[model samples]
Target: MSLVDSLKDIHLSILPQDPVKIDTFVFRLHYFWTVSFILVFSVLLSLSQYAGDPIDCIHDHNIPDDTFDRFCWVEGTWTRKLGFDAIGGQMDKAFLRKDLNFVRCFDESTNSDGKPHEDCWQHQYYQWVALVLVLQAGCFYFPRYLWQIWEQGKIQSLVSGLDRTSLIKGLQSKNELQKGEIKDKIQLMIQYWREAKGTNNLWAIKFYICELLCVLNVVAQFYFTNFFLNGQFAQVARQGLNLDENDSILPILAECRLTTYGSGGQPQLTSGLCVLPLNIVNQKFYSLYWYWLSALLVVSILALTLRILQITSHDMKKFVIVYFYRIKEFNDVILKRSNHGDWFLLIRLMDNMNDVVSSLFLDELEKIKPFEAYRADE
Candidate 1:
C-alpha cells in the first residue's frame, strides 16, 4: 500500500518468526533490530571488501604489480601528503583526523630516521569492520538471551488459552464440564500469579533488571564502537550530514610503498597511490548504524524512565492499567494489595492477553476478599 508499509513488510520478512514474544517492543528493537542490522551489514561488507581487490594501488612504472598490491593491502596503506589542517571542528589527532586532500598518484616520503612520516596514518582497518560488526551483534544479543532463559515461558504458561478474544467467545459452545475445567485453569493462573510473590517477587525484579541491561548495553556499544573505529564511528552520521569527510577515520585514498630487488638484482624503491574502495563501504555502514542506534537510545531511555515511574507512582500504574486495557471498571482493591512484582506480572498479562481475558483476570483478582489478610497469613 504505502512506502512505510512496504518497508515494514521487507523488515518482517527478514526477521525470524517467533510464536511467543517474551519482551516488549523496545526490547525487541534492541536485540532484534540492532543485532539483525549488525549481522546483515557485516555479511554484506565482508562480501564487498573480501570477495575482490579491496585496495588498488597505481604504482610507479618500474614497479611490479603483484608486489605493490600485496605489500600495501597486507602490510598497510597511508595518506602520505596531508592537506590544510583547518577543519571546522576540534581535530582528533589520536585517530589521524585530517583534511580531505589526497592530491596526485604518488607515494609519501620517509622520515630522515627511515620511519613513515608523522602525517601519514597507516590504513589497516578495512578488514576489521566485518569482525567488529559480528562482535557487536553478539554484544547486543546477550541481554535478550539472558532474559529468554530467565523468562522460561512463565508468561506463556499462564497466558496459554487466554491470548485471544475467541477464547471467551468459544466458551459458549463448550460442555459444562469443559467450561468448569477452563475456569479451573484460570483460577490456577490467578493462584500462581498471586504466589509469584512467594516465588521471588514473581521474578519481576529480575526481568526489570534485564530491561535495564538492554538500555545500558545500547549506551555502552556506542563508546565501544567509537574506540574500535578510532573515535569516529559514533559521530559519523552527524559528520556525514554536514558533508564533512576530513575527520573521518575511514579514508578514501592512501599511499603505499614497497622496496625490493629488480630482476637484475638492483635495489629499487617503489611508491604508489592506493585507492581504498572498502573504506567507502565502511563509512556508509557506520553512518547508517549511528542513526539507528541513536533512535534506539532515545526510545530505550524513555521506556526505562516510564517503567521506573510506573513502579514508584501508584497513579501511574493505575492509569496504565486502565488506559491500555480499557479496564476502567475494575476495583481498586487489588491495586492496593498488589506489590510491584504482582503488578508487573499483571501488566505483562495485559500486554499479551486479549482484552476480554485480561478484564476477566482483573475481575477475579478484585474478588479475592481481603487480600491483605491473605498476605498476612502467608
Candidate 2:
C-alpha cells in the first residue's frame, strides 16, 4: 500500500490504546510508532544499497566500467565549487550563497602550475544512510527508556485490577475476592495520597518532562539530518525545483577517479562522472520526512502545552467528575482539602474507570472531603 495508508494504520492502531496507556499518546508517537516507520524505511533503503547498483560510471577506454563503478561507490565522490562568476544568471536562488557552491572540480580549479584546488569529498554519507537512520531511531527511543526506568510501573501498580471488579459493569458479575482487592487498592491509593501530599506530583511531572523531550527531539533531528546531507537536506525543497545541469543539488552527478595498473605496472588514473540514482530517492524520501517532522513538532508542542493547561485548571479534579459523570451536586470539600498530587492521582485513577465507577469514585472522595476539611480546621 501507499505510505499514507501505512501511516494511517499505525495512527489508528495506537489511538484506541491511549486510555489504557500509562503515558500520553504523544509519547507513543515518538518512541514507539515513529520508530516503527523509520526502521521500516531504513530497511527498504538498505535493500537498494546491497541488492542494486548504487552508482554507474562511464570510464576511459582502458579502465573497466564495473571496476570504476565499484571503486567510486566504495571510495567516495566529490562535487566542484562553483563561484558566483559561474552562477552569474541564477544568483537569485537561495542555495547559491557563497557558502554553498565550492571547488568547481579538477578542470575549473586548475592553477597556473596545472594542479586542482582542495578536493571537497561529498556523498560518503549516502553509503551510511541506513545506519544513520537507525541511530536516529535510537534517539527517539531513548526518552521512553528513561521514563520507564523512573516510572517503574508506578501508575499501573496504583490502579491494579481496576477493570476486573464489578464496578465497571453491574453487581451481577461481581466476584467478592476481586471486589475487595480492587477496594483495597483504591483505599491504599487514597491513604497514600492523603499522607503523601505534594510528594506525588513528581510522578506527573516526570511524565510531562518526557513529553517535552519528544518535542525537543524533533527539533534536533532536523539539524542532524541536514548535517548528514551535507547541508543539502534543509534546502532540498528549493534546490530540487531547479534541477538543471548547473544547479544539480540533491542527486548531482559526482566525479570519481580510479587508479589501475598497465603493462609495465604503470599506475593509470582515470576519471568519470558517476550517476547516483540513490540520491534521487533520498531527495524525495527526506522531503516527506522533513514535512512529517515539521507537522509532528507542531502537534507535539501543542499537545504538551494544552495538557499543562488542563492540569492548571482550578477545579481540575472536580471538573473531571462533573464533565464525565455529570455529578453536579457533590461535596466540593475534597477539592478544597486536596493537594496537587492528590488531584493528580485521583483524576488519573478516574480516567481508567467507567462513568458508573467514576461517579462512585467521586462519592468516595466526597465522603472523605468533610472529615478531612474538619480536621484541617482543628
Candidate 3:
C-alpha cells in the first residue's frame, strides 16, 4: 500500500476528525516551540545570573537611570526596555548593561570590588553553566517522544483493513480448510489483536510527551516575564557614578540633559530591539510570589520527567505483532462454524485466539515481575 494513501484505511471516526488533526498539528508545533524555547530559556537564564546582582548604578555624581531597564523583563515585567544614557558615561559596570556584552569587570575604586569579588564571578558562571546544561539535555530527551508518536500513527493506519480481510478470507475458505488449518489461522488472528492494543499504548506516550513540551514552553515564558518585571536596575551610570569621592555631583548638567527621550529628544523607541514590558517594574517585589513561581517550575520539571519515564518504559516491540495482522474491525469479524467440512475454520479461529492470548500473557508477566516482587514484599 502507498504510505500516505494507507492512512485512510484506519477508522478514526470515533474521534472528531478535526480535533485529531488539530491536535496532531498542535503537537508538531509544540515540539518545535519547546526545543526553541529551551535554547532561548537557557541563554536568558544564563544572562539572568549575571544580571541578578544588584550593582550600584549610582556612579560619579549622577544616578544611573534606566540602564537596568533590561532587568525588568527578567524581573517579570515586559513593559519596555530600559533607556540608555544619552551622555558618554554609560552603566558599563552592570553585567546586563545594554552595552556590556561580556562579564562585568571590577574597578579598583568600585565599592563592591575587593577580596570577596572572586566569589561573585564564580557563582555567576556556575549558575549560567548549570542552566545551559539543562537546556542541552532537554534537546536530547525530546526526540524519543516524537518517534513514538510517528510509530503509533503508522500502525493505526496499517491495521485498519486487516480484520475485514481476514474474516472474509476465513468465511470463503471455510469449506476448504482442514480442521488443523482453521485452528492455526484463528490463533494467528487473535495474536494480531493483542499486538494492536500494544500499538495503541505507544501512541499514548507520544501524546504525553507533546503535552510536556507545551508545559515547558509556557513555564519558560512565565519565568521570562517575571525576570523582566521584577529584576533590579543598576543605579550607577556607565562612566563611574557621576560623582566625586565625597559623593558630590559635579556640575555636569550642561554636559548632558537627563530626559526620558532618546538622543534626538523624541520619545525613545526601544520596542523594536527589546520586547520586555516596563509597566510592572514599579510594583513591590514579593518573596512569596517568587517562591510560588519557583515551586511551579520545579513541579513542572518533575511531572515531565515522570511522563518521560512512563513513555520509555512502554514496549514498542509489542505493537509490532499487533500491527502484523492489521485488523481494523474487531466487532465485524464473526467466527463461523460450518459442517464437519467447515470445522477447520472454527478450529482455526479458536486456536488463533488462544495462541495470541497466551503469548501476550507471557510477555506481560515478564514486565510485571519486578513490580510484582515489590508489591509482594510490601
Candidate 4:
C-alpha cells in the first residue's frame, strides 16, 4: 500500500456509515423553478420597456437599465446613456414626422396659436406616457409575485413527500423479494432522486441570472439618471439663452439706476422661471426611484446568493460522501467480488446512503432559514 492506499484508508475512516444522495425529483423541481424565474424575470426586465410607446418606451423604467441596444440605438455594444442631441439616422426622421404630425393635428383641431397648442400637446403626451409607464412596470412585477407563490407551495410539497430512508430500507429488503419487484422499487427511487438533484441545480442557475440582471440594472440606472439630468439642464439653458437674447441688460440697469457704474450693468434673467419643469420632475423622481431601484437590486442579489449557497451546499455534502465512499467501496466489496457483473455492493452502498440522508432530511433542510420558517408554519 502506497500514499494512494493510505489516503483511501483515511477517507474510508472519515466516511459516514451511511450517506445519502440528494433526491433527484426535488433537485429537478428546484431547477425548474429557477429556470422559470430566469425566463420570467429576464422577459420582464428586458422586454417591459417596450410595452409602452415604442419611441419613448426607451425611457421607461419597466425594463432593467442594464440591457443594451434596447434603448436609443448606438453603433457599438449596448450602453445606458441616451447619447446624441438627436438619434442620428433615418429613425430621427420617423420620430420627427411622428411628433410633428400629432402636434399639427392637435393644433388644427384646437384652432389655437402655436404656444397654447404646444402646451396642450405636451400635457396630453406626458399624461399618456405616464399611464403607459405604469402599465409597463406592472408587467414585470405581477408575474414574479405569482410565480413566487406557486414555487413556495411546490417546495413545501417536495419537502413533505420525500421519504428516502423508507425508500432505501425497501430497496435493501429486495434481497428476499422478487427480482422484478426489487428492480422496480430501486429504479423508481433512483429516478426520483436524480430528478430532484437536477431541479435544485436549475434553480441555482436562475438565481445567478437574476443577480446578474440586478447588477446591470444598477449600472443602467446610473446612466439614465445622468441622461435625464443633462437633457433637462440643456433645455433650461437654451430657454435662458433665448430670454437673454431678447432682453437688453442696459434698459433694466437704467430702470434700476445701476447704469452709472458701467455699460454692462446687469445680467438678463427669466423671472418666475428659475426652474425647468422636467428638471424638477427628474430631480425628484430619479432620486426617489434610484433609492427604490437600489434597494430592489440589493434584495435580488441577496436572494440569488442565498439560492446558490443552498443548492451548492447540498451538492458539496453529497460529493464529499460519494468521493470517500467510492474509494472505500472499490477496495473492499468491489475488489473482493468474484464476478465483475455483480454490482450488489454498489447498489447496497447507494441504498445505505439514501437511508442516512432520508433520516436527516428535514433536520438538514431546516438549516435553510426561509425553508425553515415555511416548514414550521406549514
Where does candidate 1 clash, by residue pair? 78-255
Candidate that would win on TM-score: 1
Error of 2 at 33 (Å): 2.4
Better of 1 and 2 by TM-score: 1
TM-score of 3: 0.24
Which whole-number lDDT from 0 to 100 does residue 261 have in model 3?
57
**Ranked by TM-score, top first:** 1, 2, 4, 3
Local distance difference test, each candidate? 0.70, 0.66, 0.33, 0.32
lDDT by residue (tens digit), candidate 2, 34-142: 7877876776678778988888887565766887788888887766532223535544342345223342344523443323346344557778888888899898988
User: Model 3: per-residue lDDT, tens digit, 1-378?
Assistant: 863343234223211132112133234433333344344444444444555532212223233334533232232211111222336545333323323222222323442222222212111122233354355435433643555545444433322333433544545433333245444543444454334433444445455555666556546645553443233212212223322210101111001111235567664222111222111111111222234345545665665665454334332222322353343222111111112212222222223333333233233323334434544555
Model 4 C-alpha lDDT per residue in residues 1-378, reported as the tens digit of each score: 875575456444533222233212222222233233333332333233345322221222233423322222211111111111233523233223332222221222344232232212111121222343344344333433344443344333333333455455645432433345434444444444434432443443343454455445445645553453333423333334323211111000100000012357743211110111222332333344445455655665665554444334544333423463432111121112112111212232243344333223222323434444554655
RMSD of each: 5.8, 6.4, 18.6, 22.4
Tens digit per residue, CA lDDT, model 1, 1-378: 975575467557756646555678888888887887787777667777768777788865666676678788788776532233445454434334433344222333434223565445566767787888888888887887898788888888876765454565554432421355557777887787666653546477878888888888888888987877667675577667434353235767776667677789875656677777877777777888888888999999999998898878888888887887777777666766677877777787767655566677776665555565655555
**Whole-structure CA lDDT of model 2:** 0.66
TM-score of each: 0.79, 0.71, 0.24, 0.28
Off by over 4 Å in 1: 1-15, 61-67, 80-114, 163-185, 198-202, 241-248, 261-267, 370-378
Q: How many residue pairs clash in all the candidates, one count each?
A: 1, 4, 54, 24
* Candidate 3 colliding pairs, count: 54
Off by over 4 Å in 4: 1-129, 139-153, 156-195, 225-283, 298-361, 364-378
